[model samples]
Target: MSFSIIFFFVFFVSILFCFSNSDEVYVINTNGTKIIGRKFFTVFEDKPYAAFWKIPYAAPPVGKLRYKPPNPLRWLDKPVYNYSIPYNESCASGRTEDCLYLSIYTPIIKHIFDFPVVVWIHEDAHKHSPDFLIDEEVIVVTISLRTSIFGFLNTGDEFAGGNMGAKDILTALRWIRDNIGHFSGDINKVTVFGSESTAPIVASLLVSAAGEDLFQRVIIQGGSALSPADYRNYNFEIMNKLYWNLDGPFEKFNRTKLYELLSKSSTKKLLVASYDLFDSTEVRDNQRLINSFPLTVELSGKGAFMNKFPLEVYKRKITNNAVEVMIGYTNLDSLHKLDGFVRNRKLLKYLNYNFQYLLPFEGRRDEYGSKLYKKIRRKIMDFYFVNGTVGERSLRRFAKYMSDQVIYPILRQATLHSQVSCNNVYLYRFTYQGSFSLVWNTVLRNLNFSGATSGDEICYQFKCKSLSTAYNAEETSNERLFIKKMARLLGNFAKHGNPTPHSSDDILDGLQWLPLNPAKSVRLLNMGRELKMIKLPEAKRMEFWTQLRNEFFPDRRINDEL
Candidate 1:
């Protein structure tokens, strides 16, 4: 945690993180500003990458640093950082806090020194950008913080000293382990990846000791560590601020009346007192601010990123940190649609309107009761649509029972509790459906849909020229051998934490991918076309939703975080 030593300070270019890749010409100096990078490739593939745009590590949460956490990043004048200004344009009217900012890329190969860093924890908010696996020579970072109420609005007390969006991802990996060795990168081969809603902030920075060696390896796709809005404790920060004050205006904003009005307001008057509790369109609506916002529950001392709860810190830090894991999903990643349910799927008002949009806490479905929520939505539509009905003629078995009711009991309980606290865990189930899941509908004039949902493998690992403007040489050779077999299994699991590629053939003839054995019987794998690894594609419907969630909510909080 020490790096700020680029003190040979001179001046030529002032930003964009250093320059040139051909005939080498370099210069980097993190945090005190001054970087220069540029050199990209991949119209079809030529490798050579080296991006570096907008690299401030932190500082700039603004004015008395609202809700404070991230800090480092010394000076700043500002230059590149503009992934299309907060998701395609609209800055949602306020709160910006100069957006922390980070990006790095790197891949020019040849003598690859220390290389092996992967840091990309973005998600749907501000629509995650940084172009897929930066052509994987590995070093590819991408960051930014302050989402909803500037990082999950907490304040259960102590002038809000909690989870500042996982402390702006541990102060941007402590400025990439003291400035990623001037872009050759390799803080002991960091990995910390994420997908769909930042995979519970990378499984809350993998059961934090403030994310120990900064990272070792963990790749969660389609989320885990009980992701979908996990507040492990602080009793969900007083049930997310009284579930946003029972329709807000702080049904008496607790934490002892907003600790002197949030230490004397003005982060735009505490975000206009949380948008004046949604201008009382009958208070805190929009699915109660999308099921009461997300993330926040750090509090519990000394530079905390996560104090507990991710299966009690992955059962005491996964067998003493031998830490290496890879998780995945996407066999119809949560599918369900019914705009006129193909002209009435037994319209029990469209099967109770897509079974109240396939429940998963539709904001606490009025705490169950409409005759026990139609007898728990008819025991989950007769345990998945057969004699219990759902017919636009069983829409592909209702999109595989609404995509295994949102990805098989939280990725089969985070791969059976990280393979019984880490002995090794790897799992996949993408099952291809590319061409960006079938695009091309010149404004609904034709083909606009298919499979591949929940974060469509980020359009086959980068290069989504709007999914396809042309791809007919065997679909451009199966999209360049599926983005070089997903960058040789995420750059051979960021240089050998194991995704197999022993001296690479760029996969397909060197296939291995094993390691998830809930007691045998496996065979399968892929998103490019053909790859198999069996036994898990709804293993008897994820064991009937894990024995119906251990016979209904057996002490839920995702069964106390699995």
Candidate 2:
């Protein structure tokens, strides 16, 4: 036989062999709609589990449906769904625009019923696998949502009410509520997990009235709605820029014209224009990170995701009040920011001269040279940099400044939630340094950094495909033990709404993670080599931010001014 024929024969045989031991499983929802899944085993532990992949939660948002909220998928005639097909073919022949599917992985252990569910929301869902969480005997889910222009483009009018990404998540949650029970999942025990970019979305959900009673708990990492990059208010101006980039006339470009141009443009054209706009846009000092189409606040609309700023929602006590929360950041979460300063000397020199640019605009976007802005800038430079010079010598200080940009918003959310809500709010800081750190191994490998960076702890929670080989090589190390402990903590939270509900739990080393204390010092759980409960790390820096907020912007507004 030819070499190509031999390879194909071997591949086909291997595929058959993989599924030989597996069996098909069927579930019927409350509406009498039946769906098919498969029972399989984990790669590492060989633990039996069931997976339902490419299950449609909403109709495909294609053509005119682009930039619009997801429409709930209708199951007419109680159709029987065979979702065991290949991933690409199941998602409408692998079209990106028609990829609104969710995959569920549940433990099939004997006599085990109603496993707690964890719905993971992230931009890159392909990199994650349910191997580790499934071994923990929990039902894990990952959903794909619209992103970039399709997800977040806001025309500030009814045509494109904005925040389609958030709307997609809410829709998926509603679907889970109606159908997850058939998959042996406890809908009441749902916990939404968001890491990095998705963290802000979860934060927004926590404060949006439309998200009430959707999920009972949330775990946020490395991002928050309080961050400047969380939302955009200049909707019309940004839409005009996008339209002009597409070769459309900018004159008289109202929301109607903008909507017409966007809806008629091909996906390829929209994607190219979005890429060019994202690439050429200049970063503002107010923005810690630049995102092309961030979430937008809808002042008035039917079924609006967010009708006001998250801060305002918190002040009015009109958000979800009963959901437990676990929020934190890595010790060196923003270490990647140092890579730019290390490579570009001129960028550092300019920042040293114009130090005010380092501080977030907060409520002072147009007040750069104002006395209060200058004073706050001077204080920040004095604390983070000596002699007001930013160079290689101040790299660590710069990292701290950038890290605070991430830490402050997250910590602020925790404290604010604790003050208003009646549920327990747990806080943690991931400080474990190991060979499997995602940000280090991928980008800042040569930096010689000593702590975990942003998204470093996700691999320990899930068996990411890209890092599976490395994880296998270190299967026998202390890191493996740490992974078990982390999983236990998370699983315990999902099961009981508390990480350390029992004092004698050995996997956690009997450490009791205390919740945030609005009346006193903010308690924190440090997830380092030795797991322990301690006072917040860098307490002085947190105090400084608290004092700054009280001194200049006590309102804690999410806009340019209170």
The clash count of every prediction, one per candidate, is: 14, 0
List model 2 lDDT by residue over 272-315, tens digit each.
77774533124433423566678878856588888777777877
Tell me the RMSD of model 2 versus the true structure.
Answer: 5.8
TM-score, structure 1 vs. true: 0.33
Residue 176 of model 2: what lDDT?
93
lDDT of 1 by residue, 230-315 (tens): 45344444434433543354464455545545555555765655543333232212112232345655565767666565655544
Q: What is the lDDT of candidate 2?
A: 0.76
Write down the lDDT that model 1 would get.
0.58
Total clashes for model 2: 0
For every model shown, what is its TM-score relative to the native structure?
0.33, 0.88
Query: Which candidate number has the best lDDT?
Result: 2
**Mind sharing the TM-score for model 2?**
0.88
Candidate 1, position 414, lDDT: 56
Give the number of the best model, judged by TM-score.
2
